[model samples]
Target chain A: MVENRPVLNVITHLVLILGIVIVALPIWITFVASTHDAVRMTQAPIPMLPGGHFWENFTQTLLGSGLSGTETAPVWRMLLNSLAMALMIALGKIAISLISAFAIVYFKFPFRMMFFWLIFVTLMLPVEVRILPTFEVVADLGMLNSYWGLSIPLIASATATFMFRQVFLTIPDEMLESARIDGAGPLRFFWDILIPLSRTNIAALFVILFIYGWNQYLWPLLITTDTDMTTIVMSIKQMLEAAEQSPQWNIIMMTALLAMLPPVFVVVAMQKLFVQGLTETDK
Target chain B: MLKRVHFPRSVLPYLLVAPQILITLVFFIWPASQAVYQSFLIEDAFGLSTEFVWFENFELLVDDELYLQSFGRTIFFSAAVALLSMSAALVLAGFADRVVRGATTYRTLMIWPYAVAPVLAGALWVFMFNPTLGIFPFLLDMVGIDWNHYLNGTHAMMLVIFAAAWKQIAYNFLFYLAAMQSIPRSLIEAAAIDGAGPVRRFIDHIFPLISPTTFFLLVINAVYAFFDTFGIIHAVTQGGPANSTTILVYKVFNDGFVGLDLGGSAAQSVILMVLVIAMTVVQFRYIERKVEY
Candidate 1:
């Protein structure tokens, strides 16, 4: 850029364009596959171009049973399940993390560091590592096949708590003192002063956590044995497996598109917040 | 780390922190301890008996060929996915950072895949490469290459790897691009003025400046490939065609749920837990060191 080499500039653009193509190709193919009928999808050399049956596939996928022979909830139902789960997880995590972070940063409490370490241990024990026992615990609590089952166990986030803690630490001590001088209680101070100050962090973390909750697969797949409780993300596997027998590529790909739409929309529409939350939380 | 003007010790803070501690205790710590305890016990196939056989399960895992092969395969898969996705992202980020215009446009296009569920990503790629009706195999037929991932181990591994890496590229790209953008422009301009070409500047100045990010991303990507790609592998191959694509996580799930090998699976889970703990420690240490830089 400094030397203004036209060839280098063109090369950069070309390479970027190629990168975009590679990144977008599978999705493009998915879109193309979704636009066709079931019959056309079974043939060799599936359509690269979009077919005219997009609405037909969309309607059938969203309204009708997702895959025949498989006892899946309707696509719309699964979408609703995904939405509910995502919102619950995002809100639940933000709520618990906010209060805990408030406790850690603003209030002196017994066993605070122990509690922090407890939450820290959760970071190392992803559900994947504690699969069978965690399933047993959830089952023992009679929470399986429910929203609580879907979201509660996954809601304790060390990173979000830590992020909020970091945000609160950077706040001036004067704010707390001023709140205390104004006779604000600890809860009142947190609800008004601290919450308002960390609004952006909360919103950004929501964006990231929503995508995370929406995309959850193994946990939901394990807990929700009830077909009606199936999340859209977890249903994709059923469709994929059912496709082996029935070869409903059109319907399967349409379900795939619908499952992906909300989170992808969140990422693209909330790009700035998404980027902020990602770099901040993961780092 | 508490604020200087913190509230006095009170039950209010206990109330505030109780929910997280409760959930962590019930869900994480309890289950983790259960796994550790179960790892020391061998359950009968009919669940009629469980014997406390400390170190026997671990010993079995050590001597088990399938477990060892799975261990090796997991390392290979993690390395392959991390290397492929990170290098691709680094190259794309390098080029994306060079763009004078529409960089945001390029980035927006690139990063939305990060929001796609790993299973959905796998489904998309598996569909694209679905042996019979898939367009890729159709094209490959012209070049006389057979491409059935369902039956072929190597093809299945390649399929899962591609799917895993494809889903990860968006994340790695986002991080790499952010890292590159954070490098001081003055350093780059100075390198350019000193007669270094763009590549030379990148190699000499830009890349070195971003090595911290590279290290950070390496840990992240490794963790991702280890734990997060379960959905991808599950949806795409189910560790199929004779357990070809079965990484450690998949094997744990399969062994516990499907194979009903509770003790073996619990042992694997404990090992994975230790692995995650080690990785988390490494990450925190690296981050601490990174702050000094």
Candidate 2:
């Protein structure tokens, strides 16, 4: 709104349009590729526009085995696996983090700071750094090839707990005193007062964690040997490898689109919460 | 840090924190200690035995040319990704801030890519540049530039950097835009009244105000390029052609999981842990400083 000369305004719009195009070109190409036939996709200078085979590609990718040569799970099965994993991680992390945050903030227990530091240490050791031993631990527990195997290890982090802890610290002490005067026990206070108060924070964290769980690649790649346990995000790698020989660009791109759709949908649908969660957690 | 009106000390607190503690001990603490321990013990190829060889793995890592090269390459990769994405996001965010209409629409279009997983980002980029069949290669041929990332090491690095940066632009843009919008409008308007143009105003006033956001994003993007781009590298080049694209994290996975060099891989993991710890300390320190601001 400050001194908007005509030339400056035009340049602003042009730059923004260019940025949008640069940002969107990859997805557009992926979509166009997904809509074409496999044979058409294999040819050079692939169609810039979407083809008539959108329904065919969607059904074939989602319903049938992804690539004919590949021994991968059905796309729907992988999507279901992804959904299960995302839901488990989001819900599990929220549940444990809420309770632990409540305990740390609202109870003067022994070793409270010790527990806080212990949880804080997880922030430094991302799973990538300790992949091997972590895999061994998970394998030893016989959690491999299962939903628990997919999610529980990843959930053992402090980001959500820290976020919830921060949120709890901001609540007025008067609320707790009032709740106690009303004879609300610890669990009752947490369930009735704390949970509703942090509703937006919970929703925001869930959005971030859901996308995170859905997009997990390396851990799932390591643990899920069985095709039935494969998630859609992990399946894209398999499909890409398959494409090297078969060159099923249409189906491969279709699978890629499907793998990303759920998380991307969540982000776009809950843009406000996603942004809040991202900014809050990182801080 | 406890509340003034906290619940009385009881076993209930233990019950409340038990699940998080249990998972943390089993998964995070135990495995991390195992990584540290395994780093000191050299395991034979067949898993038949492990001999305690304190400091040998670290020594080897220090002397190993490939490991040293990967360390350098990782730094280079992180720096390049950070610079490329941050600058692009800064420009886009700056312009987005100036636009009077459709800013939200542009923001929505710009930020959805943040949800795209690194692996999927890699897949999308790799498809567009797949040498023989890729659209980019076809276009590059018009310019007489060969575009085979499969064979060219530099091209492979460029491909990975681009893919990583492309995914990160959305994140940086959002942060930069938010920071830019938070600047007092009067400052820019005052500069405008003083006959400074938009670009001049940004450089003189707005940019300095958002340096904190810039610094925070530098660390965030560096950590991201360090850890999160594993998927992108795995999908795009698999550290390929001649190990040109192998960053430290990828090397750790390849050596441990595929080559089965348990001791050395564990040592690499330990080194990465130290780096992450250092970075986390720096980030937290900066955040503390930011709070003062």
Taking the candidates in order, what DockQ does each have?
0.90, 0.88
| Tens digits of per-residue lDDT for model 2, B35-97 | 999999997868899999999999999999999999999999999999999999999999999
- Candidate 2 residues lying further than 4 Å off, grouped into runs, are B291-293
Candidate 1 lDDT, B1-293, residue by residue in tens: 88888888778888888899999999999999999999999988789988999899999999999999999999999999999999999999999998878999999999999999999989998998888888889899899999999999999999888988998999999988888887778878888888999889888877888898888888888899899999999999999889899999999999999998999999999999999999999999987787322
lDDT for each residue of candidate 1 in A164-265, tens digit (9 for 90 to 100): 999999999999888899999888888888899999999999999999999999999999989889999998898888887899998999999999999999
lDDT of each: 0.91, 0.93
Candidate 1: which stretches are off by over 4 Å? B291-293
Q: Predicted candidate 2: what Cα RMSD to the true structure?
A: 0.9
Candidate 2 per-residue C-alpha lDDT over A157-258 given as tens digits, one digit per residue, 9 for 90 to 100: 688988999999999999999999999999999999999999999999999999999999999999999999999999888888887888999999999999
Which candidate achieves the best lDDT against the true structure? 2
Docking model 2 quality class: high
